[model samples]
Target chain A: MTTFAPGRKASSSRRHPRRGEELTFWIFLAPFFVGLLIFTLLPIAWSAVLSLFDAQATVYPTIFVGLRNYIDIVTDPDFLNSIGTFLVFTVFIVPVTLVCSLGLALLVNRLPHGAGFFRTVIFLPTACSYVVASLIWKLGLFNGLESSLANQVLALFGQQPIYSWLNQFPLFWILLVTVRLWLQIGFYMLLFSAALQRVPEQLYEAASIDGVRSSWRMFWSITWPQLRSTTSAVILLLMIAAFQAFDEFYNLVGAGPTARPPLVYLYNRAFTQQDFGHGSAGALVLTLIMVVVALLQNRFFGFGAADDDSPRKRASRKKVAA
Target chain B: MPGIGSTQISRRQMAGILGLGAVTPLVLAACSGPGASTGGGGSHPTLSQWYHQYGEAGTEQAAKKYAASYKDATVNVNWVAGDYASKLNTRLLAGSGVDVFENNAINIADARAGKYADMTSIIEPIKDQFSETALYNVQIDGKYWGIPMIIDPQAFYYNKAMFSDAGLEVPTTMEAFYECVAKLSSGGKKGIFLSNTDGGAGFSSTMAWATGTDIIASDNKTNGFSGDVDALAETYSWFRKIQQNGFGLQGQPSDWWDITPFANRKIGIQWGGMWSMPQAVKALGDDVGMFPMPPSGSNGTYALIGSNWNQQVAQKSPNRKAALEFAKWLWVDQKQDQEDWALSYGFHIPPLKAVAASASKLQSGAAKEFVDAFTKYGKATGPYYTNEIGQAMEDAGTNIIVKGADAKTQLAAAAKKIDASLATLQ
Candidate 1:
């Protein structure tokens, strides 16, 4: 009988990976590390270098102008408008998406059968590309009062079609918000659904026997407290996504006259207008703002957090389960 | 569904994983060398040529035929359909753009950066073969940047049926044109379908052509566009008058109106371009006819004729000989292509005088009349027409038409910018 002791030569031999194992680990990690450096770190470094120059299109030679590009970006009215648009988008979309997703998860959880099928149906929109969705919304679903499906239904009731819904102010924001909600609610619902399943079934049964008959009472006492971590994570993810609303606006309204998100505007300044320096400066400012928002959300909400788990919390959870 | 025996990913781990997966390859590719457009049979020294979506299948066929005729050379033509400038600029910046490509005057300033080759010798010999106005567009700062391939003059098109219904003859003068507008609008029909958004700038182009305006008089460094301002104000006054008279800014606006409304018989006359006629022929089905805008005061100033795409070689091209060879062949050797492009979709007037007279089929009688009018009475813009000053004036003029911004205010602002831009040019 071979007993493997902790420090025994045979046990140590079994514990340490062979040279082949070490090589295999690096081989597996090589692809991912290379990708990170190329796509994220390198472009970031290049952009930082570009931000100081006056990089016009192939015409004017690019010259390093120190913080002039940054000054221009901060002072530009167009930049301010983009920030305002992003704030409005974030303020409305984050809470709305969260509540709707939570509500949907609870609804589907109560369903007696075919929960998996319903979950798939709800989550389907998230899988579709933003460009595809925006196109459908632009040409087919919200084209105009006369041609759109929504307007056609509205017309049946003798009401004017909501033509130019995206053209008008505030309404355009609401429309964008609605489209985003349609896309993301399903994914978050699935997340909360899984979290709800993890919540011990016995506690809910006890609460029921104790005459906690009201749905709100049950949710407040049981579901809400349990979903705190998940809700925090989902909200934080949503806030980050909202800041990067370029694909939707870029496809729909284009960078023509009206629809100019910060990223789109940055792209236009850098590429279209051939002002690479300005474009780089704009990109950095936008990056800083987004990173700050993400950090703040992470700190306050404890979303995407590794420190969420602790011995005390684990003990309490086990006791609650028991 | 997410937590069902699934592992939780740490943020740092996720970042490291994604960074390795996504960023590394792209950075490496950028750092290496220019990515070529096509890899094919190496029987010939293949050069990549970029074109726009404007020309249809006939243009492509013509280009291919030209490439096939070349000995020890093959040209691979890439057609860009949308977001062209952005893509081209990206390739240019990355040091990986095509050998020869077509771009418009609007983007010429950028194309002339240290990236494009000076084609003074190649273009100088062929310059006299082109309309003086067409030749002017290819030159930037006393150097030939490109070879002009086609001339597209913005013109006016009217439905023959709509005109007959209104019992109106085609207007012969600017005054007569406005009178026709009044007659057309009285019977619940729009006089024009102009979108203020695009029309403001578009209208300014032809207006400058008609007014004989020397938009900018540049003597090396000192820039002048005071004359352009006077002409712009006069042109905006005309458009404002038309709008205020209950034309009702309705339907798809701007120059795109040459077909949409005219096809539906919703409007009698549309201010558009020679390129617009073919689409009109398709939509209205053989009843379409066009004429140059009536003279402002009968001094022979009519429509502003200009070229759309010009071909230039990259100065930084390691294969300079290959790039210029490809460019010269694209514009000159492809004479059949030049003719076919000139004739395609009724949109082009060939830069080659021979193609216009021989190969192009301008069947409409009104078109023939305008052809004669150009031969006898047309006035091409001067060399100053293609300068930084001209562009600034155009920008100023466009703002007035679109925004109804005070022409004097906008024009003056345009002058200052023009002056600043000119100072840098020298």
Candidate 2:
């Protein structure tokens, strides 16, 4: 019998390990790839194809009208108006969410006690479905009935009842903004809190020793700068979410000329009007807008860059330079 | 010294968790797909019937009971809830499962696209049983595509107690109606509640009819409201004036479909349907009365009448013959079930004249008055009155009545849009 060394088996296994490892890696990745291909990639491809046809109520399009659908949507007054409405909504909602969520995160982060309790309390609304939250806001609070909570509060201040806040333009923005802030601010606050924790304590101590007595100054110098990446992410997400606003508008404001958003307009065009070609074209146009905005934001903020260069890394680099 | 934290999970474990997370939904979907079919595994052919979820109790159970009684094929009743029209349209396009369905109005475009089957042979014998107007809606190119289910007559329901207490006679003219509204707006009660916010949505058709003008012309090609645009504008101006003067409720807690405002004495009058008669009777007992839209200029008062539901067979159903047999048997042959469907849960006029004549609820006081109004002043919605056209009219009316936009301009713009949409249908 030939003598066998104990380490030879290990060496032989290492030499041929990559094939099995590769197979296992693919096995783990297959489900996700398959799902993404079937649900996301296929629908996107089909929508792009659909945008070129004059498909009405039917599944198959007999007439291929190239660029006409796009031209019609661009010139369509209603589609343009819907885009304007969404922009107005985003302009107001995004900054308000950023400020409010940051303020909340700062306040919660500074608490010596009951921080967890307050964080959970603030984050509770995020768990609620948008539809349910919208209905509660619409029917329970701003129902336009004299007996509603909002009107009751108004009555306490010796003001007359204001019915149907949704019907009132510009004033209804307050309602939409309030509900969105209530639902979304919590998650963003958590994100800010996590980023705040990763901020080095030594920097704050050093700043305090350098005679920086004001908390505002310290925050502006340290905390805000430390949260640059998180803030950029929050803003990008908020803009995308604001652009895709449909549920709250659909549930609260309903279909009317008053507050028709782009998605709702697209829905009416596709399903209600049975003009699939126009709907698909509108969707592609919306997607293009979102992509352009995201690219612009990335260009300004450099979000795609790896944010691994900490103070230590910079100091080591400075030492090398010296 | 520790290298990595002991609490950290291994890469293999992480991969396993992520893989499970992604695979779970797909596996669940695969497992649940076949179980979703309501048809049991048997030799008998199973037919799927769809109905929009009705608000009234016992409607679903009644549908199930009716389906259970059909022995020719196993009938699976699918009570669809929320956005039924869109869902039905999608399923019909997919061309699967749906053997029969209930539609409020048949789309002529869908009919031309071969979405619905021709039911003329089944209805030709009993076609005389249904009213002429009911038959008129389903007839496309001299062929019936659907069978009428129920007739819902919409009119204004007034509180008799409030009217009598105010010593107000039922107003028969537009001017008299305005005076009645003004008189009723006292003692913490408003004169009328048209709808929650649209300020009388469906009533525009009634108003046009009352003005002796058709909203959609007989030819279904041109705008009918254009015939007497000035008169229609004047009528809308009167609505705006009433709204401005606070004679009508500006914003109520309930919508136009709800009879609660009139029942609870919150408003003197409300635009409601015959479907809510049971709720009105339960709340106001003998204190309720019905009236049509008061005559505007020289036309007689008009009651808005439309089909509540119509049974249709999907043209793509594999078992179309069996499905048709089930539909005719249930909707046509069984008159008792039809009456039950109309009168038992919530009040609706049976489409069959013979069944309607024998309905006990239709022979009495308030119900009888409603029936009489429906018979005398009833105006059926034209076959060409589609959801798109309805939406245009609503928008124009809202602009005129609520926002006080120029009525002639708004109506003209609306007519233009309607003509364009109707052209597409042609």
Candidate 3:
């Protein structure tokens, strides 16, 4: 074993000079820092300031009403309804997406041939623009006319024609969930497939040698435990994506009252009603909810935790040796 | 390794390249401004005229042609494609290069906030030549803020062959209208097509007028539908029946704005605007006939008459005078252009009374019937009927008609919301 004298090595390297290394470090970081300041930080600060004012008529706020906008948004029935609608959408879509994507990934991973073609075909819908996909679903497939594809298939089965899938209650939810599933399933499936590929062949072989004859037992013992990190990441991403759903809902249902999500509600308040202050407050509240949820998820999953054999743990172990 | 002098020279060149890269975007951004010129090359003050994209063919070319013909100023017509209202509002707030633009309804708050210029001086001289309803919403605080461009009167257009086959005459009462719908809906054909997306929002104005209720009070502060809740509820129940009985086309390929369903014989009757006359004529020939929404209560038959487009000069425009003069020259002084704009491309009634009367298109067939119906029963909305109030009513209508909510409860809720909005206006 080689001994690591990390303190002496650090002291020697700090005492020495490298030509142009410091300049290169800053040169690479400058662009990213500039962009962060300009695009992300500035807008966040400005929106925070705007949330404290009353800007109903003009672009700039003329009256300062501290926390009143926030109070109003929390009390507003339409805003609350939008939140309820989004939560319902999330509860339905997140688990369905997880199960469907995982199933697809497992099926594809088990295939020995034509796997690439299957993956590509399944992934094709992800490449389509949300607006174009929504229009195709609305005008071509679910159009309530007797000649639409859905109705035509139903007609063959002797089923009566049902009109206005978007206006109907549970069917509207199904429509939204189906379109979103078609768009997002391929990406999550690819993630799970990559994670599945990383599991060692020896783990499955060892479990089988120990009399684990069933595939279910092998998966539970050898496959699932190995995919903990990826599963956590996938669930977190799906939750966040479910919260920020705007394009599909906007293009499908439009600004109708029945299916208004929070983002659409905020958009109408800001652009349609010209109430920027309340809209900004609503955005801030949504951001806070997202951050809290992310924090709770991180707390439960312990994402980015250093493994015993990781480089970070190794470096700390060497420091302890010093 | 390179020599010191050569290395220094290379470093200087590198610095110069990076500097250029950093400054290029700034220079380009400075060169590019909002509402940058798309067409006009003249030295005259180019007055930018913005218009929402008209679906009718040749409307854009006609607008540009009219602009090019104006000798007083170089007019650059900007045909905004999608979400014209939102874009226009944003630009107005930015106080950009919009010298003039078109909107169907002028928001009084925007006008009061000084976003639009007063066109009273130009409109007052020939105001009498325009119909009273044409100038109704344009005048704010007894001053005209916009020039009326064209009038689109919406009425019922029925398939003549289908009506005759059903052995039905034109409906003169609400009960008879339902009976006619049921008769026409036989054999897989929908009886009527209102709007696919928002249920019956397109026909709510006409329905209210037919029921002898002004949705908005003349005082512009109180709700008018509250006075006759039973009658209004009855009308909404009719809409619900149309949907529940499948008498109305629910999800067609196109919205009610297009005459495709009517033209394709998928729907027997359509509550469509006069703008679809050309398309209907092209598809159905003489099989189309038009009539106003018949009397529901003691009210007489009525058609919804509203401005198709109104031209208004921006308040912050540098060339306000030039813009106003061009608007007057196009919409008011040049009577032939008004007639051409109304009849040539899409068949709208000219806002100017004489121009509409003189147009040969308005003299015969279904077009003549539409004109007659409009003349006898065109009911205009109040000046205070803003988009917010309109949206509230539309939501209530959707609730009552599509969702089968309690009509009285929804209307009461809508009235409360509308009163709150009006209070803000006050």
lDDT of each: 0.67, 0.81, 0.81
**Each model's interface RMSD (Å)?**
9.0, 6.4, 4.5
Q: Give the fraction of reference interface contacts each candidate recovers.
A: 0.09, 0.22, 0.32
Tens-place lDDT per residue, model 2, B1-426, is: 322323344687669778888999898766532212334334466888999988889999999999999987888888988898898888778777688888887877778778899999988987888877677778876788888898888888888998998899888877777777888887645788886566674477888888888778888887798978887887787788776665666445446887877888877888888989999999999888888887776554554565558899999887788778888998898999999999998888888899999999989867888888887877677557776677678778877876778999988988987797788677
Weakest lDDT window of 10 consecutive positions for candidate 2 chain A: A304-313
Question: For residues B267-306, could you state the per-residue lDDT of candidate 3 as single tens digits?
Answer: 7899888989988988998989987876776653554556
What is the C-alpha DockQ of each candidate?
0.10, 0.20, 0.36
Off by over 4 Å in 3: A1-35, A303-322, B1-43, B297-303
Task: Give me the candidate number with maximum TM-score.
Answer: 3
lDDT of 1 by residue, A1-322 (tens): 9785667876776787566566556667876897799898997887888888766664334677899989989986557867776777788989999999999999899899988999999999999888888777766776542657767888899986653454344546655777888999999999999999999999889999998999889899998988888988887788778877888777655453344568877765776566677888899998898788767776666665665354446567899999
lDDT of 2 at B240: 82
Residues A1-322, model 2: lDDT tens digits: 9888879988987776655465565666887899899889997888777889977777677789998999989987678878998999998889999999999999999999999999999999999999999888888888767888888999999997775476555657877889999999999999999999999999999999999999999999999989988998999999899889988888776666567799988988888767788889999999999989877876667565555554445567899999
Clashing pairs in 3: none
